[model samples]
Target: MNSLWSGSERVRIVERLKATLAGVVELELLRCKHLEMVDAALEDRASAAANAAELPAEEGIRAPGSTASEAEHGSTTSRRQQVSAILKVIRGHIGACVGPVFNPLLSPSLSPGYDFAAVLEWFAERVDRIILLFDAHKLDISDEFSEVIRALKNHEDKMRVVLNKADQISTQQLMRVYGALMWSLGKIINTPEVVRVYIGSFWAQPLLVPDNRKLFEAEEQDLFLDIQSLPRNAALRKLNDLIKRARLAKVQAYIISSLKKDMPSVFGKESKKKELIANLGETYHRIEKEHQISPGDFPNLAKMQELLNAQDFTKFAALKPKLLEAVEDMLANDIARLMAMVRQEEAAMPSQTVKGGAFEGVMTGPFGHGYGEGASEGIDELEWVVGRDKPTYDEIFYTLSPINGKVSGAAAKKEMLKSKLPNTVLGKIWKLADVDKDGLLDDDEFALANHLIKVKLEGHELPAALPEHLIPPSKRGSSLEA
Candidate 1:
């Protein structure tokens, strides 16, 4: 009887182990299936987005809603809403370092230019610069690279080329490679020097030798000299100046064209003159609000004092109608003055340019535009255009049609908020709507709220500039005013 009991216990143990192994296998399969589903969804969404982006502008699409009106508006609005949501979520998960967010190893290529180009276009409307980094050892310039380079050159002087992997090659080899790259690239692009290259392995460190202080010091000096000899800093300054000038030029051309179109109507009748004056007043108010300054505050000494404290000469210049219309030309003159100042500053310094800001490794190519999810080092403040009253992400995406797909999840929430009045404006309207001081909005509150926004558009002052009180006093100057 004892022998039989022992045998049964051993058999039970064996069965338990089998069950545990089977459970692990099942879990793995489930994970694989989930990943596959995610990939398929992403592919479908990407294709839809691409098609929507190409749709003609005549189609009037409302924001994404379940209603027939939204569907008829075509998929453009839906796509943008979807993309924005995905990006927002992806951005949030970037630093988590846990599971595969997007298949990191899906593409083996070090620098995929086509993928990079799409990213550039998305950022073009939002930022002034885009930097691309490459592993010099694996550098293979493809058609995609040419396309990106062309697009960047045409857009403005904001594209920078960074060549990485310096520690892998000897100093002599690095210099030779740099020269070869510059010579080959010089023929194709206007500014060969703009393709900045640097050599250093983020993963590798120089070997330290014990009791060899002199040798170590000599090696360090050599590295410093090599870095100094690189022309990256000079190249970046030139590029920044070039981009600023280009932006100014584009603005100038637009103003001139607009003025030419409007010149005929400016000289009509007394009635026309009155109408024009009203239009001009409205225009002035719109411009002031767009710059986030109060309409009443303008024409007041206090406002001018505020402007001076802010060092916002650009906003001051924008207020003048002649300057507003000719903003491009005005900006061009500003750029020229800025360039002269930079040159003067450089000349005064022993080092031609300060090795700081975004230009630090300009020549050595250490600064590449390739930023990973977990790798963004500094604060990223994005400035993009939206209509008066601080349009929401949904409104901007619907207007621009930058991304193409069905909006979902957190993106939907953000878009919903964006479509409504801004929080500050909403808060003000809510205050006016809520006759009772309770926090929640009931039926009466909702009806009154709608009425307020309708009237708010007609005569309401832009929401009190996002209060500086929200920001720490030390950082108030840098915070974005809603």
Candidate 2:
């Protein structure tokens, strides 16, 4: 068995296990427990890798000159023991018996299809979800298991296939593999229900992992603060209070004009006054009918007349603007506070982690070090300190901006963003900012940032203004004049 498989094969297995373990952790976060079998398989592989790594190096030993073959045999035994240990852990967690496992390359006498079918049956009974990890470098399973794959497609939502060792395969081969997998899956399941196929390299640096971890943790903290600052229930209560104050202000204004004493003259004739009083009753009834308020809770016509006799319109008029202003202030303060909390949370986060060679340009500092000042001169007076200039549109779009329009109106700035961004990043930004069902983003749509901030604080109105410079170039002319 040791002679049959190379060191590269073992390494590939170890890589797959690591990838699976990471996926398991992610699934755990999402509260999905259906991948217990896959998790167990991953644990087994990880233990084997650890055991292999721990073995003493036999660098100087030769097969004939030393006991190197014996040592290698012992290592192999240890590896098997590690694998068994992992399998035991998996079995314990799975709580069910699985079918016979076979090595397709070594076990030439045994039929791969028969073994695969048996395993599938075992999984169907004992596992809630199935994940097929294939070695694209070795056998092609798509053609061999076309019928079974079709059958599995009926449960595509419950299954996924990972094309392992994608980095080893040529681009054309990878596409052909993907196409075959998709075609086979589509035959078994509806297009919408088909399971996803991921082409991943476990050894490759994750595109977002460390940075996303920091971003998500910071986002969670911001979310908590946002929730704490503006409790929805409490805001609704305040809204009701503001509405009541507005109604009272309107009522007080009518009384201050001395209109109650000459109600008949104000309304018209005596009969008209009565009609006007009746109209108030009708309005109250209409409110009750609409379930906005209860007529029984309001003052009766005669009681209302008495209250009006004592009311002062000047006081009401004076309070009206104040109440409105109070509501506006409360909303604005809460919104500003929430935004501050978010910005503070983001600011405290570590600088974004750079992943892969692709992000190197973005991660590199504005200019090379030592280009500005030499270190030994105790901050030489001759050396110029970098000016605190605001970020340019290009800098903001490329280095500082999120790939998705999470920064607001980022998609609308695509032409500007394209100057320095990759097409993949721009595509993601477009998807995020083109939220309105319309494909394009206009200046009005660009104001979504302000809208989001206002809505979060229970204020429906957008901010009084956006910065004139942030306005799109085409709209700036009209807006600046206004």
Candidate 3:
């Protein structure tokens, strides 16, 4: 068996497990709430029944010969059933507050027709923010992720990337990957502002392997502070879902009423039904554009319809009070409970992690010792600081194109270079950078290429920390803007 296949299989299995675990934890929380709601509803109903029982027989209970009290009792029973159905609707909607990347194999409705992009857009509508997480061992942004970054640049205010599993790599490796990641992110988002990148193991505890024992032990709180901070949306997302529910309730009432118009009925009852229908029409028109949400957004609408129709809502007019009460409970307690939890978690978190890396300029360290530095340094202060060993030409190539090191034997590297540079300029870059006729760029060559991109193509000054000798002839005597 191929070792790579086994490792990939393990990863797939682990992803499935995580998705399943998330589903279980969320459902368990909801189930507990359901049990509590059921007990409260039952207790309240029992108290009401007991109160009725305590009333004088002549006042509360109809005499065996009279039917008015029996009719009232039936209405009360029907209302209780309506309350139960409404509770289910509230429960179903509460779990989907954020997008859960569900497996299509588990349920097609999650990524319906396997259109994950469309599903992602659907999720984008619901969420106020997005977390883009990746492993620290391989922090290089790939082509696929570049597309995501570009697509989400519109929501850049809400974006933050978590570089997880830092404990899996060495300090030197972590620092190198971190520098590369920041550079890649700057290019992707097309921004000078540094991207927020939380660096730590996201697991309960960082594995104390020899690879990262030093940094893992040094950072006390680890990723907890950052994870807690990521969800800090300024305002709680006020879903216009309430309007949709109101529209839905009115539509259902109208439909149920219209279905009864042809039936044999007393003139007085028929007139009342027509009046209620007209009122519902007016209410629907008033709220039609109040919210862009629709009943179609809820996946289990078929089941919900069954639940709504499951009871004897034939007396729905009488049951509206209980239905409304259930909605009120959901708004006050159920939805509030979850939103409050998120807000409290955010509030309790210490203000340490950077949100979107507002203040973090390009960081440089020991790897850039030979790099130039002087008083009043500006752009040059940002140095190439990967490690003690200078980066290789192949490393630079691989960084530019994932296909560079692949066994598939593709000309992806050439294509990548072309994409970044014009033919006339690229030929000049090749002559200056690749000093050896070996068709590869070494550290000197790599630095030269970067300098070309920064100065010539991007019209940005080369980092002043770059060794003065490495500066191309054209940029040597030119004065740079701060």
Candidate 4:
């Protein structure tokens, strides 16, 4: 839902020609600023959307299995509980919201240092997808960036290479450039599968070469569909990562205990420890052969060697089979049960209405057939009515433009003052007029307001609350009777 793009200058500032802790701090500050902008933009869009689609006085998608009367009055307990559960899960996860409230240590990158290499690693972990932008006219990879590409190679599934400004080259030239780019990547990535490359002129300006316009459009859609699938595939991806981590942890435990058991109990401890560190690769192979585990699950050899050089292997804890068995059991049995529960929940949900290539809302079932089976029966005896001329009332309501669909409490108060009624009498009318208690008056509510004002002006006392028959039909979830 959000993105932080650091330009070349910003990238250089973070690198500082050498690794520095200040670069990480600087990136955090930049992220905080970007979050502020995203929030402001969302708020503006939400407000505009609200004004554009003014719902019936009652707001919210009515929860399934609730009485229509309950939705008309307010949210039901079951609905509230469902909402609370969703928010609880979402708010607890880091990067779940577009805000600057998450702990920095909990951020995706394993590295605490934010050098150029570390930045790429952090981004590879943080984002759902990565796009490597390149100029198609001159395809080249600098030697300085080889380390960064190697880090990205670990996340090849998330990577997509884009040959931007491709229209600047002819069809034959683009073919040669793409081939060269793949050759360069094959050397750096060390992967068997070829990288997926998108070729296009990704800007507002017209394409220099129109021959590939159709091809470019299709490529653009392919990228969009890939990005769109991220939200849907997120849970599966997290579950897969959990299984990978569990496998890696089991391997690590075995490696550590093997080293500890190899240490000398009496003399020559230093020489023995040095020898183990020197032959760490052999230890990994031995552990893999004994346990029948994949070598890929082992930690980075160079990094592990550097860490092991300073460790006293004899102090390492012995591997506990019970702990490893429990993890394996959870992965094999408990996770399968969890997935079954997810499928059950998905099947029990209501189908949504798709309008104009977008999901609109839950289908309320056919109108007048009853909102559900028992809902229509509850309000069949009552209906909304105004005592005065509706058109005359609507003419006055329409003048409250842009927000003409709804009038705020203060604006309604100003108009009610012209009635010359006492504040006490006006207060009661306002309460009855705003049937939904949302503190805003739509067209029907505004007409209901004028009807009530006329009643009070004629020396009739207003009720404490609007009677069921007089409650706006929109709020009562029923249309006016002809």
Q: In model 1, which runs have C-alpha deviations exceeding 4 angstroms? A: 1-118, 122-130, 154-160, 169-176, 192-194, 204-325, 328-482
lDDT of 2 by residue, 1-482 (tens): 22334799747644554543343333233222323434566689979965665445455434342366466557656756665676567662312222112333124443332334434544443433355666556635444455455434323444656665565666667678778767755665565655655565434544322423332333333332332333223333343444433333333333322233434434345564454454655545654565344332443466455343323322222223433344344334533443444455545545443243433342234332222122111123332211112233334334434444333443445443534544554454344333443565543333332222223234222223333333344544665575
What is the C-alpha lDDT profile of model 3 across 400-466, one tens digit per residue?
Answer: 5533333111332363364476666656655555444456654444555555554455433333344
Error of 4 at 318 (Å): 1.3
Model 4 weakest lDDT span, ten residues long? 94-103
- The 10 consecutive residues of candidate 2 with the worst lDDT sum are 369-378
Model 3 has an lDDT value of: 0.47
Q: Give the TM-score of candidate 1.
A: 0.28
Maximum-lDDT candidate: 4
TM-score leader: 4
Candidate 4's clash total is 0
Question: Which candidate, 1 or 2, has the higher lDDT?
Answer: 2
Candidate 2 lands at a TM-score of: 0.26
Q: Name the candidate, 1 or 4, with the larger TM-score value.
A: 4
TM-scores, each model vs. reference: 0.28, 0.26, 0.27, 0.48
CA RMSD (A), model 1:
36.0
Inter-residue clash pairs, candidate 4 = none
**What shift in Å separates residue 72 of candidate 2 from its native position after superposition?**
29
Off by over 4 Å in 2: 1-87, 92-108, 111-116, 136-139, 142-154, 169-173, 188-192, 204-482
Candidate 2 vs 3: which has more lDDT: 3
lDDT of each: 0.41, 0.42, 0.47, 0.64
Question: How good is model 3 by TM-score?
Answer: 0.27
